[model samples]
Target: MKKILLACSAGMSTSLLVAKMKEAAEKRGTEVEIWAVAQDKAPSEMKKADVLLIGPQMRFMKKKFAVVAEEVGIPLDVIDPVAYGRIDGEAVLNKAIELIGE
Candidate 1:
């Protein structure tokens, strides 16, 4: 199973998105482990993740995270603001899958 990690200013904000992503994964019969954490926890979390997606509000942190993500050998990107604001789970899930190439 692929592991997708999401980071926001605070972990709480992404909980809903994580749930939605899980629902989207279920609908597509995809097995994935998705979770969210505060920006400070991201580096440790990324060690076990296949991909790291930063919440739009935390987009500025992407460059900082890029180095760690590269060391961990995982794809990392900022969640699209439009999709994130809309809480479009499938779009996010698709993006994760595309990043993982699975």
Candidate 2:
């Protein structure tokens, strides 16, 4: 299963989004592992992920994560504020697939 890892300031806010993404995946019958991680945990977590998405609030740190992502060989994208504000699970999932090509 493809793994999509999300990083936010504290991980709590994105938990709800993770739930929505899970539901969307379930509805589409997509077998993927999704989870949220605090920025502090990102370095360790990205190693296990196929793609990494950073919450809008954490966008400033994208460059930092980008380096780690490249080292880990995973595509990293910053979630659009609009999609994130709306909790657009399908859109985010599709974006992840588009980024990782899986």
For every candidate in turn, the CA RMSD to the true structure comes to 0.6, 0.7
Stretches of model 1 off by over 4 angstroms after superposition: none
lDDT for each residue of candidate 2 in 1-102, tens digit (9 for 90 to 100): 889999999999999888888889899899999999999999999999999999999999999999999999999999989989999998888898889896
TM per candidate: 0.98, 0.97
Candidate 2 segments whose C-alpha is farther than 4 A from its true place: none
Cα lDDT tens digits, model 1, 33-76, are 99999999999999999999999999889899999999999999
lDDT of each: 0.95, 0.93
In terms of lDDT, which candidate is strongest? 1
Q: Report the alpha-carbon TM-score of model 2 versus the true structure.
A: 0.97
What is the model-wide C-alpha lDDT for candidate 1? 0.95
